[model samples]
Target chain A: MTVAAARVPAASTPSFIGGMSRRAKVIWTRRLVLLGLVVAFEIYARFIGNPRLFSPPSAIVYALFDEILVDPRIRGAIYQAFTEVLVAYVMAIIIGLVVGLSVGWSNFGRRSFYPIVILLYAIPQVILLPLFVLTFGIGPACKIAFGVSHGIFPIIVNVVAGMRNVNALYLRSASSMGASNFDLARHVYFPHMVPSLFAGLRLGMTLTLLGVILAELYVSTGGIGYWTKLYAETFDPAPLFALIAVLAVMAILLNELVRIAERRFTRWRN
Target chain B: MNDQANFTTRSIQVAFLAIMAGVWYGLTKTGAVTPLFLPPMDIVYATFMRLVQTGQFWSAVRVTLFTIAQAWIIAVVAGLLVAYLVTRSRHWTAVMEPLIASTFAIPLTLLFPVFILFFGIGPASKVAYAATYGFFPVALITIAGLNSVDERYLRAAKSMGASSFDTFRHVLFPAAFPVILTGLRVSFFISFASVLGGETLSSAAGVGKAISLAAELMEPARMYAWIVFVIITAVSLNFIVSAIENRRREY
Candidate 1:
């Protein structure tokens, strides 16, 4: 298996120049394909497609700043949603790290509680959205709580796995050097866990975004959800598309931030 | 010492669960937490039993299950076809894999409005929304699986003058099966969650809708019951998928 894996890149890399040019060509083709899709959508939306159901990209872009951003309430809602995600994510990291360490540090703790944690993680927490609203009320609190709930599990699971997966050889060597528990953790286990923890952070971010948005959409009395619901109900596709576009951009930026952090922290892996 | 440690841990696990149930019971009984927020355990159980006996519960479950089934089917077909096409060339794989993965980062739930506009506020909307949301993971994982197929195996197959179809069947398919199965499991749960989320957001039918309705009507017990049912379903699905994967590994 290892030989086969090594042979793959060797076979593929022989025509490095050809590969580079082919990759460049493919990148251009991909861009053109996306442009072509947009042009097609524009033409269809302008002619055949119902304006209420579909909006051209040009119109959507125009509405993004003109109609959506111009509305102060809508802007506030978007800002609020962003804040909720940020706050929830930070909280998730802290809580998840603490819980993960507590649960994963000892073999007995892991054996006793890890299965229960996994069981909780398996449950679709979306089912508890209403319950969250009932408990936290229809405010940013509910959304933040939901996001934290969704985000924390992945971090905890990954951290526990990371702690358990530290090389036994490394531990033995560290102890042979008369390293203390803290030294072993700081120099060996912590570095080893960085990559996995970042993986969890990425997943946790996605789930946090999902949870926050799901709650926001459910409680459509205010927030970005209200604007989306309003536009959809009023059959206003342009503004709705524009609003969704802004949120999509926000989600992408947030994910990219996490990705950048992951790259920075996991540099030693290379 | 190890045996004593094991016994202590086992006892701790049981005690943890018991204490949780006890706190819940005590809170509701003493009115420390309102029944509206945390219904009494007995009331929740009674409601669960009653819901199971009702045709309404079954119908809601059926709607949700049917929507998930349709969404999963569409996601699998479309995802595999796209993934297979993308993996045909290394260049295409390089260009498309990141495209699919980056899109997965964007909360596709944000596009539920577009789905609602297109499909209306029915199970159709939920199906469309879920299938789109579920498509990314499936397609991305399938691409990864197909890309990871050992080139040596393909080369050997070609050296033997094997047909492309035979090479794919004998070499590629078996190698990709486990990853693709994992993708399928993930997609199934994605579909399930998205369907429930759609129903909760806008739909007039399904288990999620039922839960929302119960909550809106202040029927806390019924709401708890519905939530419990969904949790059980999710847990059971996880177990079933894990069991199947475990059994397959034995082969």
Candidate 2:
């Protein structure tokens, strides 16, 4: 008993330190590498890079507040884009869920419409950007429509897959217990589909963002697209870089929110 | 029961397509939607046939295809090299994988303006933009594939005094082949799409530019034709890739 007690500290001590050091090393390396890259870029942009083509990080930071934020029009454009994404995402979830359930619920639905869905999904929807704009006009309506179109396919695919792959035993047992179709859907299918649905949501967010941004850029008359084009044309890299950085941060935040929701919804799996 | 379901589904599929075509014809014939937005189906078909005959269409197709090929090649080489190097160490993998993934999440399209600034409004810009965009999936998937090889196999090979190259050739290559192939497939599509998008947004020439020009010119029929051509190409590519993947899986 005494030997065992004494050996506990000996065994735990090295492993605890080793694990801590390994984690620390990883974190430090990641930070240092990123920092090094940024610093390199800064130096290049300041000294060697063309002013019209690149801006230093410091200048970009200044431009973010002084130039980008100060402009009410730009701010409104950014807000409009954000709203477009939110509305499109919600619409996508609703439509995708309905479509996915309808298509996946029955064998007939799966065999008949799933192929069509897949065919549509496989088409590079970017090619349709012009068509969407022409049909919906050069407004947020077009962007939202485009975003929804991009986002819905993944959700539908994932939900159908989830429904199709639900354990047969679970369904059989539920049916044997005299569960109604509604009860079967609620008790057996919903839980089975949650994780995959969340997976689809995450993908859908990315695609929706891509779609909206693509439309915005394509229009190039107003909104974020116009500003980006304007900056590019006028040889102003600082504000352009700053604006992109802001958008990137927004994208990261949106993605993180979806990831958080995914984790929360899939907690039952653990 | 299965046979009945299959038959029903097949009939439904046919009915659905027929109804869609009918609706298109009816709407155009009734002039509910203007010809400017939704050109008559016949005009679209005629424009497609005419486009097929045009030297301009061929040149645009050639340009886009050439750009995609170059971008995909660059992406494959760079992505594989980076992934392979990063996978050489566990610590490096842990540190770099998330960095790569997070960077990928930032919608690389945002940087197209920067690319334009650097490479100008040409196929060169499209190539660079697409290669940069395509590199992420390839590298990330390759890293995952390489990292997932059975440790026991590696140990056994080491115990048998197998060289690194031999072990990679015999064990690692086969095991990682499937995942890497998936990555390649994804990267190819991404490169294709990004190239098209870049061209659409800002380019002097290409299929995308043609479509954009048609849209600007308010020639809905011509634009629809180009759109049709792109859709057909994309769908065919997808079919070919999936077929190849399935064939590979059977082996």
Cα lDDT tens digits for candidate 2, B1-251: 87888888889878888998899899999999899989999999999999889899999999999999999999999999998888877888878887887787667889998888888998999999999988987888888888889989989998999888888888887889888887787888899999999999999999899999999999999999999889888999889888887887798
Top candidate by DockQ: 1
Off by over 4 Å in 2: A1-18, A175-182, B1-7, B162-166
Q: TM-score of predicted model 1?
A: 0.93
Every candidate's DockQ is 0.52, 0.44
Task: Determine which window of 10 residues in candidate 2 chain A has minimal summed lDDT.
Answer: A1-10
CAPRI tier of model 2: acceptable
- Model 1, A1-270: lDDT tens digits are 111111122112112246567867867977987899999999999999988899999999999989989989989999999999999999999999989878987788899899788878888787888889999999999999999999898888888888998888898999999999889878888898897787778878988998899999999899988889889999999999999999999999999899889889988779
> How far out, in Å, is residue B7 in model 2?
4.4
* Model 2's TM-score against the true structure: 0.93
| Model 2: per-residue Cα lDDT over A1-270, one tens digit each | 011111111101112235777978888998999999999999999999888888999999999999999999999999999999999999999999999999998777889999889888888888888889888999999999999999898889888988998988899999999999989888999899897787778778888898888898898999999999999999999999999998888888999999888788888789
Which regions in candidate 1 have their CA more than 4 angstroms from the true location? A1-20, A172-184, B1-12
Per-residue lDDT of A190 in model 1: 87
